[model samples]
Structures are given as C-alpha cells and as structure tokens.
Target: MHPVSTPTVLVDEEDRIITVLAGRPLGDDWDEVHAEISTLLHDAGPKVGKPRKQERRGDYTSLSFGVSYGGGQRAPGNLVQGECSRTVIRDISQTKAVQRAAGFMNGCFAAYAPKLYEEYRSNLSQLFAEYPHLEQIFPNSVFPTATFNCGPRVVTLDHVDNTNVPFGFCAIFACGSYDPVRGGHLILFDLGLVIRFPPGSTILVPSGTLRHGSTSTQPNETRQSFTQYCPGGLLRWVAYGFQPVGSAKPALRRWFEEHHDERCKRAVGLFSKLSDLQQDRQAVFSLKGSV
Candidate 1:
C-alpha cells in the first residue's frame, strides 16, 4: 500500500522548500500526454534537418520555431536558429492545436503528478507572498514561455534566469530509456549533485537557485524531457522574453569566488605535504598545478 502522504503544498521548515513524490506512475496519463505531444509535433510540420555545428568551445547552434495557439487559431511561427541544434520554441496559446496540447500536458501533470504540481504551485505562491516586489511585475502564477532544448548531445551553457521573482521549475523526463549509461543526467553545479532520472520521473528544482545542465550523449542516443518555469513575482512578468536576469548571478559569482579561494588553499597545503611523500622530487613539481 502507498504510504500516508502529507500535503505537498506545505514547505519544509528545514530547507524552506516543498517537494512531493507522486504516489502513482506518470504512465497513468501517458497516452494523453503522448497524443498532445504528437499533435504539436505534427503541427510543427516537417523539421528541416540541419546539423548543429559547434561554433565555439561552448557554443552550438540549432534550428527552431515557435508554435502559438489562442483564439481558435494554430499559428506556426517561422523557423529560427537557437543555441541548440534540435531546439524549438512552442508557444501553446497562439494556436488551437498548441492550446490543446498545453491543456493535455498540464492535465497530465496535474492529475498523474499532482504532488509535483502542487509543490510547484506552493513554492511559487510562497515566493511571491514573501517577495511582494515580484508580484508587481508578474501577477500571473504561470508565465508565458517557450522551450527549445531537446536533442541528443544538446548542451545548454551555464546560465541564470533574468528576473528577480522566486520561481519553481520542473523537468519531467519521458525518454523511454532508464539506463544510467545513457547520457541524460541532470547536473546541478551549485550543489555538486547529479540526478539520473528515468522515464516518468519528474524533478522539481528551485529555479533562480540552482545552476544546472545536462550531460552529453553518445551517437544515435536521443533524450526527451519537458521543462516548465512557473512565475512567482511581478518582475517575472515584466522581464518575460528579455533574458534570464536575477540575484542568482551575484550569488553564484560569490560562491565561485569563495570556492576557488578555498580550493587554492587546499591545493597549496596538499602540494607541501606531497613534496615530503615524493622525497622533494622535481618530478612532482610538474603535477602541482594539475587540479
């Protein structure tokens, strides 16, 4: 039998965050989600195959487009290039087909993953309640958004959102494979935590709090997942479509600065002790700066 569950909307006093694991498998709504995704893909039309070539050490480009559905019209926007090769920005409310797709996806999350959805809603509400400044800009609980990152070997460079509102984000992995050997782990740089989520597993991350990215994949390996950002404050609404901006930048910068200093001190101490272990050999000097 499933364990007695707590109200997912309540925040943990220790971490001041809310996280809920659903009691049921997301497969309960898999058919509905799949159909909606299929319709959206069909409306997206034929994707012009284009190889995403990396232009710089950390920069890669891909072709993408936007799907907007609202007021009984399913309008497909012109294809545009993005940082990832297989990315596409889908605007659900701009097209009837997309609106249906969004509704289906939202329903799946709310029904099959009610716990996760509740946590997301609770966290965002709490954030806005505490940070009244954010509500002034983004009064809506949900933000108008589009996502364009989904493909094999897709790499999103380390970055932060461009808003001051506290937001909760989630990524539901639907990729069929459950193997750890597959390159689909979500890496959280700030916490040094790597999460390997199998298909049907949903991860709730405190957006504007964590810096994360995905691992690279082998050839012929494709990964599928859905990511959504829920708004918490007014600033979030005002900053929509501008870029990800927030206090996270300064916070991350400070963390890295202090972290590097600590690492330097440790390295110096380790090197001094290593000299004794190596009989003060000149050969060990070459490995001193390795880390």
Candidate 2:
C-alpha cells in the first residue's frame, strides 16, 4: 500500500483531531536520525529488555521514563509522583541520543500540530511547577512521559492505552529501517486507517481511545518506535488542585461532579479541526518564541 504522501489530519464528527500524520519533519535527515536512534537502541542491548512477554506486543523490548500518578500507585503526598526511569535510561550511556530522539519527536509535534503541542506543554509545565522535584526525561520535551519500543522487530496486537489522557494526544515516532509499504503500517482500528508509517515520521493520536497497533515487518528487517504521552491520572491530579481525585476537598469534588459534562465538552474542544488548522498553525507561530 502506498503511504500517505502528504501530512494529514483525521477528525471526528465534533471536529476533534483523531490523529495527525505528520510526515517527515526531518526531511533529508530522516535516514541519519533514524539510524542514530536505531544504533542507540541496539547498543542498549539487554538493558532495553528484548523479547517482550506482553501478549499485546508480539516480541520486543520496551522501557518508559518520566513521572506517572496512576496505575494503582499509592495516593500522592504533598508532592506528585517521582520519576519512573527504567534500565535503558539508568543503565545505558546513550542519554544524549535518547534526548535527541525525544526532541525530534517533540519538534515534529510542535510543527505539525501546534495547538496540541501547546496543550501538552502547558499542562506538563504546570505539573512540574507544582512539583519541582520531579525529574523530566527530557527538559525540551513537551510530554511528561515517554516510552521506547526497542525492537529488532517491533509489532503490536490491537490495543488502546486506556490509561493515557482520554482527550489528549500521544506522539509516536517511528524509527529504524523497514519497508513501510510491506510492513510498519499503523492501523487505527476505530478510524479504519491503515497508514503506511515510514521511518523517522511521527503521528499524534488519542491513544487512550484509539485501538492501534502496527503491521508486521519482514523477518530480516528492524523496526522500533518511541512514544510520548501523558496519563489521564496525571492531568486529573493537576486539575484536582494538585491532589488525587479521591483526596480532593468536598466542595471541589462537588463542583467537579456538577460540571462533569461541561468539562468533557471543553476537553473535546482542545482538538483542532481540519478547517481551522491553518488559522491554528498561524496563531501558534505568531506567538513569541513559539515551540
């Protein structure tokens, strides 16, 4: 299948962006960037955890970095949660390369979907401000959390990241060499899109809601991906006055309960419609020191 030749955005009936095919923001440097990232992942070797046991992800090693407030952790204290850097970040000496890959993905997000970028930046900034002790995986990155799908052959069974921010976007950067037409296609089950995802390209999607995975690559080919996302619990922790939802004051809880529907509408409105994308892009660029 021929890949999408141009940048594209898919939206729902309410004009919310379901996904954005951000093309190759690195242009001629795609080969170089992906190669460097691939080398870094390869060098990480056992630290990256090969041969994933998860049924959802066929056979690949993966690691995550950054702070998370959910997934059955104890209630937060005065401060938010601490960083969750895995062996890849702690044991490997490729911090710079990892940071570079993250920045590249973040930059692609800022360039192609500025509004979503700003939203992520704003919320993450606020989260960090309230809890200054938390360590960010990459200070330049807009996302609060990131995952490295280290794979000699990375492919996934259909699944949704239900823990991620339901209305927020997750940036997925495809890396490593593979035949995009024959394999490495991103399948969005809900949207009915089988996007031919090329190496070094990025896509932003509502992963918490979209059932997505990748097609298989050839036996000899290599495929890997890096993803940046924010968990819904983190956002809620921020919105709940820097406390867990269950720990919020009675009045504050009452107010949130009363305005639940209104808040949902507001959350959905964060997505930029295709018709307004030009204006949104211009508005984002017009800001002083945008991105």
TM-score of 1: 0.44
Clash pairs of candidate 2? none
Which digits, one per residue and each the tens of the lDDT, describe model 2 over residues 177-217?
79888999999998788998988778888899889999998
Residue-by-residue lDDT tens digits, candidate 1, 44-127: 323533246643212332222322222222221222344332333424224443343344334434432333344444444544
The list of candidate 1 runs beyond 4 A from truth reads 1-13, 18-141, 170-181, 230-291
For every model shown, what is its TM-score relative to the native structure?
0.44, 0.87
